[model samples]
Target: MRLQGKTAIVTGAASGIGRATAVKFAREGAAVLTADLDDGATQDVVKEIETDGGTAYGIATDITVRANVDAMVAAAIGRFGKIDALVNNAGSRIIKSFLDHTEDDWRRMLDVNLTGHFLCCQAVLPHMLDAGVGRIINMASIAGNVGRPNRVGYVAAKGGLLAMTRALAADMAGKNITVNALAPGMIASPMNRGFKENDAFGENWNCENLARRWGEPEDVANVAAFLASDDAAFITGETVTVDGGSIAALVRQGE
Candidate 1:
């Protein structure tokens, strides 16, 4: 009930980390607006929240488009009367080697991962700014900080997202709007289906982290919930890494 009476808009709420965060927000008493490209999937999330005695709604949205982004914001405010938080959790990966990547790959990555965050923030910030308090949570990736194979474009987009999160926080300093990012490592979601299916890759991640286990979607969601709550009122311009201490550990093979 930390978020009681607050309203939150979560992008990419159809599945994976997005769905987990949206559900968690609702559970914490936020009136959640779950936005996703899939209408049916989004509705399912909405239903889940409702079944749990939480307030929520589903909107089919493509965050890369300005009109859709604006409409999503409008609908959220229209239903909830005001918007208090935004989780920029929508993004996809382009898993290709640097040489194999084309201009389209780069464009798509930035459009969905980076540009979408920009557009959503642009659409919702005026309301937050006017209210004099708000939370903007951006979903970044560990690849943004560390090198990853066959993910040049994804790395670039996530890196840009991290930088943008910092810039937004700096710009909003003393304005009561907090901007932050969550960088997750090896979350066991649909996004990492291939790795989960591969025994060697799965084992590597399972054993690399100090926790000796893969991170669940709820792990990141718990942190996001905290950032959205008053408990994190003074925390801004930070990128919290929730990776079971993998980012701090240097586990080498055969050593």
Candidate 2:
């Protein structure tokens, strides 16, 4: 297995892409520490992984809080003995227009999507540095790369994450640590179930992508496994888009 004997901490792992990544990491031979605010849900995920013969643990964590972030790091260290990778996947989005977005909305988006990732990175960096080898996968979005009309705060937060990925990669240069971001497309995760329910929204995304279908969380999770593995040792500061050609083709595949 690619991740044999490694340890990974995955945030927002209660569901969707986060849960998928945690399971994938564990299956690939990593001891996974899954963190999310939904304790029962995350515990369920760990149980499922354990049932499948994977090493996994779950913790209730609010990434927006520093104390919680500290506890998360400590839990991983205490349970797994060392940290090999950190996947900053915990995030939230508000579907409101730029004009309709309030200050509080903006703060909430930035707090969950950007600041939370920042805090987690800070808390885990020292341990990674101590180990002398690490991978940090920050979850970004295609909306950040291409502006989405109704999600101002989400776009801004993810854009900031993209920049932060590059900056941290530079900071970690020569330290045997790599920082990268994964820009997922319109994934068919529970987080986007609302959009999926809306015919117009779902149709538009499907039509926009060359794949002509919504992306599955596993699609992104597969890349997560690769990025967290040594196979990506030479990669850093890169944003790998898992949108199934949505960003590349200005013209839709069939259109």
Candidate 3:
């Protein structure tokens, strides 16, 4: 139980990486607060975790809203007594070319993917400062590192998130708080279902990574658990790529 006796708040816990991370943290002995806009799905995740003999609660939250973010943090502390970690996993994407992207799309992407994290961190950091122990894990993407063609707004938002992660980590130095980010690649998650459904893109994506297949949500969740645990105490200001070597290799199919 790496996270034994801890408490965590995972935003976007209704599905995909967020849900997986919440379940994983609970399984590792952390009391989890699963926050998401999807009330039914979020509660279902809480049920799954509880059925597995883990501790969890569900809250309907829209991280993009300041009031909702504050409420989510308050709920965690009220239910779990203390907040040990905050996983800023809530995100949005706009897969459109730069020329086709509208002002609303750009703002929406930044609002959900970047501003929401800022609000969550602001709301949670005070509690961590009071306790003198905490973890902040931002769920970034490999596309942030190496930009994607059609996802202009998403790339900008995630890239900004990466930069924000480093800056926050630096700010929390020597504070017993570690801030880190996870950059996942080609995960078969609902967020990327549109892209994955395209046969040509999916086939190419399957062969682009060293793993030669799509990554499961569990794969990223496992790493998230480590970051939240004491094992990563000394590790801060780092962006751990959970991409199966997709960022490190240029795989050529039919080689």
Candidate 4:
């Protein structure tokens, strides 16, 4: 019950990492406002939280639009009375060659993955500022830090997200507002379905990390929960890599 009295807003709460984080926060006693583009899916998440004896509500939101973002925040405050934390987990990816990417593709990718987060932060910060304390968690990716193939736009967006996290934290310094990021590597989520379907690719990636297995959404959710809690009150402007130690290890092929 680390977040017993907290109220949190989790974007992209329909599935994957977003769903896991929403459930985890609710279990820890946060009154969560689950926002997602899918109205039905968000309601499902809300139901799950309610079944577990937690307080929560679902709202259909398109974070890329400023109006929708503002409405989502208003809804949260209206239901929960205040906002204590925010998890910017909504994103999109394009697994196409850089040359194959179109201008629309590039712009849309950034709109969902980077700019949407920016809008969400902008909409929520004023309320947080009024309260004088808040936590902002940005869901970044390991690809942002390391090079990867066929995802130039995704890499750029995530990389920019990490940089934004740092800048926001700097600006929030001494304001009792903490901003941080989580860089996850090869998690088993709908976003990685294509790679996981390829047995060889899945097996090879499993060995790329120290854990020798894929990361679960809950793996990252646990860390997000901590960051949202008072336990991490002193921590800010940091990127916590939740990759099963993949970045720290150098496992040679066939080792």
Worst 10 residues of 1 by lDDT: 199-208
The residue-by-residue lDDT of candidate 3 on 81-199, one tens digit each, is 89999999988777778999999999999999999999999999999999999999999999879968988889999999999999999999889999999999888889878768887
* Whole-model lDDT values for every prediction: 0.93, 0.94, 0.92, 0.94
Model 4 over residues 1-255: C-alpha lDDT tens digits?
Answer: 999999999999999999999999999999999999999999999999999999999999999999999999999999998999999999878989999999999998899999999999999999999999999999999988998899999999999999999999999989999999999998898888777888768645655788888898999999999999999999999999999888887887678
Off by over 4 Å in 2: 200-205, 252-254
Provide the RMSD of all predictions against the true structure, rounded to 1 decimal: 1.2, 1.3, 1.1, 1.1
Q: Write the per-residue lDDT of candidate 2 for residues 105-195, one digit (tens) a residue.
A: 9999999999999999999999999889999999999887888888999999999999999999999999999999999988989998887
Q: Name the runs in model 1 displaced over 4 angstroms.
A: 203-206, 253-255
What would the per-residue lDDT of candidate 1 be over residues 92-180, giving only the tens digit for each residue?
99888899999999899999999999999999999999899999999998888998899888898999999999999999989999999
Q: How far is candidate 4 from the true structure (C-alpha RMSD, Å)?
A: 1.1
Q: Candidate 4 — which residues are off by over 4 angstroms? A: none
